[model samples]
Target chain A: MGTEDDVTPVARPGRPYDRSRDAQILAVTLDALAEREYEHVTIDAVAQRAGRAKTTLYRRWPTKVDLVLAAVEAAGRPPEADELPDEGTLRADLLAVVDSPWLGGPERRLAIFTGLTSAARSSDRLADAVRTTVTEPYVAVYRALLQRAVDRGQVAAELAPRVPLLAQVIPAMSGHRLGATGEPAGREFFVSVVDQVVLPALAHPPGPATPA
Target chain B: MGTEDDVTPVARPGRPYDRSRDAQILAVTLDALAEREYEHVTIDAVAQRAGRAKTTLYRRWPTKVDLVLAAVEAAGRPPEADELPDEGTLRADLLAVVDSPWLGGPERRLAIFTGLTSAARSSDRLADAVRTTVTEPYVAVYRALLQRAVDRGQVAAELAPRVPLLAQVIPAMSGHRLGATGEPAGREFFVSVVDQVVLPALAHPPGPATPA
Candidate 1:
């Protein structure tokens, strides 16, 4: 097993570099990850595939977890608020998100989660980095989309306030599908959750029902 | 590293045995897990603590993952449907599940999941065993409880049918809390998820909104 001493050294300020080296390294990491599980993917292998020196790889990432996280970060673009579709409804926007190739794909989500699980187990700093870099940004984009729907009266006003619920449920749904079936997420999964589960709970405000 | 040969032997039909030996062994397994993370909880240590022969332990379980999973199984009783509180309300029944001492405690749940993560990485057999023995049974209880509530007309009739949603979301919520906070799960976390997230999602029947 490689240890802390195996980390690559950082590049010096004066050295000339290939501009695409970072992308090359990241692409190699994804390919290796897809081919094997997280534990099997190593810095040496990534460097070998990228055709870059091990020292150069280490110069950029202090640990293998860091390298894997960087690769995960590079795998997909974060969901953007402006990119959200306006079908004149909150449900449509949610459908759009669930249906998007980014959230819906199995391999892509698994690749990201594999890095996350490794980081969560091995190092606290890496765990925090993953949360901020991968989890939070996507959650923020979803929340903003929901908030926009609320502002437009597409959804109830009170619905926008429950950030934690959306944050927790969406990922849980995806993770559950992955854990059980290892299949890509689908729009019906999200729509069922939002319509059959989320919407009804939100429809009635948080007070006692009126007397019959 | 104790390999496959390190396992203790199982009890045979003709063998003289201590009736309390199984309990003692399981207790030692829990103690070892609590003191050390799953990776460090060796069969040797468990054998030493239980004053049992290594071959005996190995005979019972061929792998460390099996041993650890057995310990988790012995730690808590399966949730029983008869034990569920039925106040004739969906919220109340869900809240009872949320507040279940076995499910709500962080250390126990975390330890169980830690073992699961390791098993998921190392052995497919262990993973399947865990899913069948632990996850499936617990889900069955919850599903039964929901079915009861639906029959009572407390929850929407259609809401009880989404097994995949319920099966995935509840554990995912608990796992997410443990991953994020590194703390025990609490009643508030469970209540918020059920009321704000799960109940609403379930209560809402899936449909397209009428053109406003």
Candidate 2:
């Protein structure tokens, strides 16, 4: 998997640490986290895999939780508000998120999520980290997308308030699939969820305007 | 928490086993499971807690996985189709499921789910057990409820085909909450999901009939 990107050193402020070096180590950490339970993932192993000294990892992250959280945060970079896909229709906009890089591919991302979720079950800090890094960013992106649709008159203005909850539908289902089945939900499943659940819910909100 | 029901031994066929005794043991197992991870739950501890001999417990359930699977199955008895809530509205009927005994109360059910889900993340056997014991039954109940609505002309007939997929929304979200935060998704949260997501999705499914 080594490419020219692995050799390219991106600049960062505050310290002399190379951003690409941090990215490289974090990527390795994520791969290890994806493969095994959190307790089983040792910093020594990550350092070895990343071709860095264990002391260097300790100097950077100090704790396994810190390292893991950093890796998760790095990998889960949701598209910025300006970067959201605008495919004209609300459905298309949402569908675009299914394959978005922020989600990663089906295999690695779900495995990483499964590992982190299992860890989160015992540690409140890890749970909070996941909510902040993984869930919230995705939720924000969805809310932004939904807001865009609302502004364009693609979705009802009355449904605007529900953007927060509605945004969670896909992420919740994806989380559930990994937790319950220990497998990644594929594109077809996401499509089914968006089409059969999310869109329908948006279209048929039980508001004052609805008939009894 | 001990009651007269704990002392009552309901009769069961085969090997002269008492149904109530089995129920009592399973309840204890569920409680322990709720309190900690699956790997930490020992048969000897369960036997001691249940007031049964270790030999007796071994004779019945042979392994930890077997015992756990049995306990989960015993707890998750979805109501019969005829027993579904007929509140005369699809929304009310769906909401009634939130408070159903089969789901248990918020605390115990969610905790048990978190434990099972964490275990499921590592074991395909446990994952399958959860699907069979917990998820499938709930899905069936939801499908039945939705079908009942269709029969009553409450939900559109065209939405019948998506019943199975639609039935999964609440369970998936609930599963996500436990897995991500190790917390029960509260009644308020369930209400929001139903009002904002499930019902709306049912009303607005994507089909050929939908306007471009």
Candidate 3:
């Protein structure tokens, strides 16, 4: 995932790369990924689809893995803490989080994720990129929202310590739904998970914590 | 997934397929699947690996899809309703469900599942096979266990209608964990999900049912 500074010609000795075209190239990369598996995605195809020279993509991202990682990173930038919705209630915030277009909605996001499935298993870098760029941020946002609810006395203070574990429920379920069914989990499904599962789980009085 | 009757020679007009050997071939199919992506698995390779003639395999399962489907079905036999654990409590039943060596335990199951990721998207039959063979049975077991708890006066009766929705939480979360991290969700993770998410959600008092 390169920023403008990484592509600026000052870092390289040769030709000046057109920084403005990076977004288009990345978008095409994602499209290529969405349409095919990771092993099948080639930098050559990406360049041709983006209507750019091979050298241009190579100068920035040296390998297919690099390009895919960058495209995924760009397509799913992690939300800043302040950028998350503060809807005054955990349920509202959780609902808003899923509704936001973080990775071009659930359909496109699932396509992109499925595209990287095989590669991620073998490539630690790709796994880390997906975890850090896509999964971790969502989990963090949920955790923060849960903590916020506890602080507001909407959720029980006794459950505050369990916030970290509870935070992963919605994201895990959403990801699982997408992976297992090969269908995007829509707003309705998200609402059900929030209302039926997450909200209810939060409502439970803390039982004696079992140490694993 | 096939029963013993499927391989018996009574139905076929040609050479008698070794009904006993069908299990060995299916096991090899699963091994192949666990080792490689669906596209990469070949009947020739499976025959070689299993020390059987290619024609023999073709006689039994005509195509790669057919063989893979049969293998998956064989590997993951859906539990009969009565076969599920009735451990007196819903939590114990769920823990038992996860702990049961269903699909050869979590690690092999995850490997087998990840191997099918790409093909499942395009092949409706494969998708259905996975859903019916793997996902549906687990969901059903959880649902039954939850319903039993309601019947036994352990879980709240108000939550009875929510059984179907609540049942999916553990399976969906487990599936998500496997897909995202490419790791087997072991007993410890399963216990956490049950205690921290499933049980808590079950404990929550129902609100006015929101219509989708």
Top candidate when judged by DockQ against the true structure:
2
**Candidate 1 residue-wise lDDT, B27-110, digit = tens:** 677667555555667898899888999998898778887787666566544555447666556566665665555633545554
For every model shown, what is its TM-score relative to the native structure? 0.71, 0.69, 0.72
lDDT of 1 by residue, A37-139 (tens): 5677789999998898999999878688888776655654454533766655556555666555553254455554654554444555656766666666656
The lDDT leader among the candidates is 2
lDDT of each: 0.60, 0.72, 0.71
Descending-TM-score candidate ranking: 3, 1, 2
Place model 2 in a CAPRI quality band.
acceptable
- What TM-score, to 2 decimals, does candidate 2 have? 0.69
Compared with the true structure, what per-residue lDDT tens digits does model 3 show for residues A108-204? 6556666665456546688778777777777888898888888878888987766887788777776667656666566777777777777778883
* Each candidate's fnat: 0.65, 0.79, 0.73
Interface Cα RMSD, each model: 3.0, 2.8, 3.5
